[model samples]
Target: MSQNERFDNNDSDSLILSFNGDANHEFQEINENLGIVRDVIRNLVPLGAIKVAEGIVIEPVVDYVFESCKRNPNMVFVTLYYARGLQEIDHHEGDSVGPALRDMRKKRIECSELLARELVHKFNDQDLLFTKVLTKRYAFSQYDEISNRKNALDLATRLYSEMGNCGAIFLSDNEVQACVYALWSGHLVPRISRTFPILAVIDYYIPNHNLNFLENFKNLELLNIPRNQYLLDVFSYIMFLIIYTMVAANYNEIRELNGFLEGSMYLLVFSFILNDIRTLQKHGIKEFLYFRRILSLILHVILATDFALRIKHVTSFDHSIPQFHRKALSLVPIFLYWRVLLTLEAFQPIGRWLTQISRILKKSMSYYILLALAFIAFFQSFLVLENTHKRHEGDDDHLGDKNEWGIFALLVKGILNAPDFPGASKLENRFGFVLYSVYVFTVSVILFAVLLPLFMTAFATRRSVPEEYLAHFAHIVIRKVKHNQPTRYNYPSPFNLLYFTLVLPISSLSIIIGHNHIRLYANIEKFLTRIIFFIPMIGFALIETHFVNDKQDKEARDLDLRELPGLPFPEDEKQMLRRILYGLNDIKEQHRSLHFRLEAIESQLA
Candidate 1:
């Protein structure tokens, strides 16, 4: 007889002792793993299981699906088990998988014809255990079905006696659902899953998690395998959270830290993939058991970092200095673009205190306020134009003029022409006179061709002019120029608030009037440096805000549309509570028993 048979048939007392020792070690490992599994289950499972269960009359479709799968080893069950196993293997040691495992036996071969003694012993010793151990490991939950028995104790007895191959055992849906429920309910400790799902469950708990519950599975625990996979998931999730938090700080330093976050997330994802492949090889199926766990971690890290970087760049920016000071400022244009659409509507709570006050007083003063705003808008545009013109004529040395601005000096230096400006600077080379000329020409054309026509149209006798709209549009334009003032516009000399209030407005208006008469706006110096850098950044920010608003609107509309379909709506709070209760339910034994028989038959055929 083979050594394995000898060992298997040996005296029971010593074997029992050895088994007990092994079981103890295994239990310790599993206990450690359970900590992680519990976290994952907590994150993944829905919180309102109890309430959902109450409302969730097990539909005929779900029953049919469950029953149908029982007669045949369902793809879902096989896939989940196999995938989980492979992932575990990969996590333990990735290099040992794939071609390595397949070729390992051969690597130990020592002779051309004779069997390597170690290979013969290895095969003989492991083959029996491979069959029995694998079978027991996978079929634990389905032990009853494997033995064609009712009770778990009976099933375990049969398994011990029949000593079947690994392929005969399969976990049932009932067990998985039960375990998930149990974990959610705080009864059972999670053993296999990761923490991401637990967090998802928590988020879900916010809106809905309650359901009607029939069974409570709060005391379950995996006594065999370690929960290392779950631990890894938790570790990765924590890292992802850290990365996201740092990003949220809205500092340049956070973006600079993205490289570290990205690298760590990538490594964790890579580990998960390897784990997945290994599980496939060992379990003989594919499962996403760890897929989302890894993905969630990675996604959170990447998005958080990106968002933080964006916030930092946006909040640190000050538009009040340099050329922008003299110009009026509007947050809308600064952040608007097709790719980065933004709108004040999208950001409702930004300055709602002022907004609320305006709204409250709107009925009494809106028309007058609007009229005054129109004047402000028009006069502001004219003042900006005048300042821009004066700056162009008076400044021979752009560097000297930029230096005078102090804090804004570095930012505005590039707009000046290199060859014509007194000091040769980097901006002159990067943006030559040609680019400047094009910008100047475009602005001149727009002023004469666009604004002039619009102004003339306002004076037309037959048409009722919308002076308010013109004022608002002009306001936006002049506001942009003022916010971007230092790049091209000259500030009033006295620097006092009153002096700024009067001379700036008047000067801006004079430039427009003079341009209308002489077409002298054409001769105005190039503002290409301002055009290139300022426009895109501001435009992009505004566009981003708009798109965000549009997306939110579309989602609300979709939700409203769904409500029109006449589906019964559950009480949100009860639903959430039920989900939590249901998540803790355990029916692994029932599911495993039903599925094991089918899997055994399939295994026989194979």
Candidate 2:
């Protein structure tokens, strides 16, 4: 056989073994070797073991196993095992040297295995391939030990240069998982999910389709119990509504309800401000820029101003100025409207519809502007003609005055085609009647004719906005409101204000300082700090477990049964199976082509 034929046969044999051979046996062998390595390391002291392993048994055996695994790219389990063993040894030594060396070795193994797999699998999925490459680059930039920081710096520099030429990788599900795991392991810095492309994609694609009203009701019921900052806000808003309703119904008995309403309003404003501050802290200034948030903030200011005005009026200090009270009363409707708008966000469908309407209006803005200008010009022309004709046919008969059209009345009459419209039988002059007819046609009929099509086109071309973007906002709000935190800190307005302002800041600072100088603190102090933080976390977790009910997992399982590429299919093996079918199709096509060529050759020979 030719050399190429032999090579092709060997490739086919390897492909067969990869799919049908017992992966379990290879896994068991790798596990056994890992056990031996661990046992040998456990027998020696940290210092002596490092020196002896360098000169004798440990280094050579690990190198040999790693090198042999190179021939079989599918044996990544072996590399993973070796890395785990080395990490254990590094932990045992309580020194940076072992981990530094291990990290370097792991980097090499990861790169080699990744490249080999890419060549062997030859996956058609660009997304998957890009993610693998990104993960490899990220892994190289992260070292397992502080001593290897310089190596990390060098890797980062090289990776940055390569990235510039290759372009940024599109984040797939696998890349998201890798990046998240790396972050959890302290290889990557803590960042907002929006900072990472994969995480952002996940946030955008994962639909929050399920809404548990029972859970929401339970949360609402427990609003006053003081569980967290979010609940406090809800509680305050509810109380404000109740008080405002009572005050509105009992305005005549204002003196009696003043104290209660004022107090509730104060609490409401404080809670709103606190929530806004928390949002600012979490998402930075961008949160305040959102339309809903901006409107809410404006309402807060208006309400606070109103409250101050009411106080002044009650104290008899500003009794002379009834205008202040009127101003405050005028703002009440606006505040109520703002609150109603906020509630729209809780129901996604309504919010989506509103979003679509807003989009259509934005697209049709120019048409509306043109219509407005036409109306203005026509109204002005009619007003000028009415004044001129009235003066021309002076008040001698007093007939012009009786038939006169006021500016406001003329504009309304003209638009609505009322009986008093100038071109209607009311106008006597031929020129004036012709002018009025032209104005009505231009402003009403023609302008609307142009506008109707634009409106129709705008509505017809409306696209379904991705629910993911909308869901992300809702998720943030939901997370905040349903956040599990210590009950003690979730006090009502005044107390919450104190806790958040004073206690929370001090506690946060101490935690940060304690973490940095952990050894300086005694075990008891460390344990106490951990318990304090863990209490809120555990409570939140339990609440989520009972209420959230693993919706994400359920969605993933449903997707899998439907053969959809859901979140859990990041490591899917189905793609590999498809490769075999693709190969068969290619072979069939090649055979048919060769047969056609053979037929042509035989006919020519004949």
Best by TM-score: 2
lDDT score, candidate 2: 0.45
Assess candidate 1 and give its lDDT. 0.31
lDDT of 1 by residue, 54-115 (tens): 12222332333333333222212222232233334544775665655423212111010011
lDDT of 2 by residue, 1-606 (tens): 999999999999998887545544544554554454344333332332233222333334444443444433222333333333343454565555655555443343233223222332333433333233222222211223222211111222222222221101111123322332222212222111433322221111111222354443323222222123343344455666776676656666433435666576677677667767765764578656556677778877877786777677677745554466556656766666656555454344655555555556666677677767877886676666666666777653433443334454655566675525443323336765676677667667755765687678556745533232132222333233222221212344434565566556656666788765534443444344334334334444345335443232323222112234443544356456556756886899999999999999999999
The TM-score measured for candidate 2 stands at 0.42
Off by over 4 Å in 2: 1-243, 254-257, 274-287, 317-327, 343-346, 371-501, 504-542, 554-606
Q: Candidate 1: where are CA atoms >4 Å away?
A: 1-235, 245-274, 280-285, 289-606
Candidates in order have lDDT scores of 0.31, 0.45
CA error at residue 442 for candidate 2, angstroms: 5.8
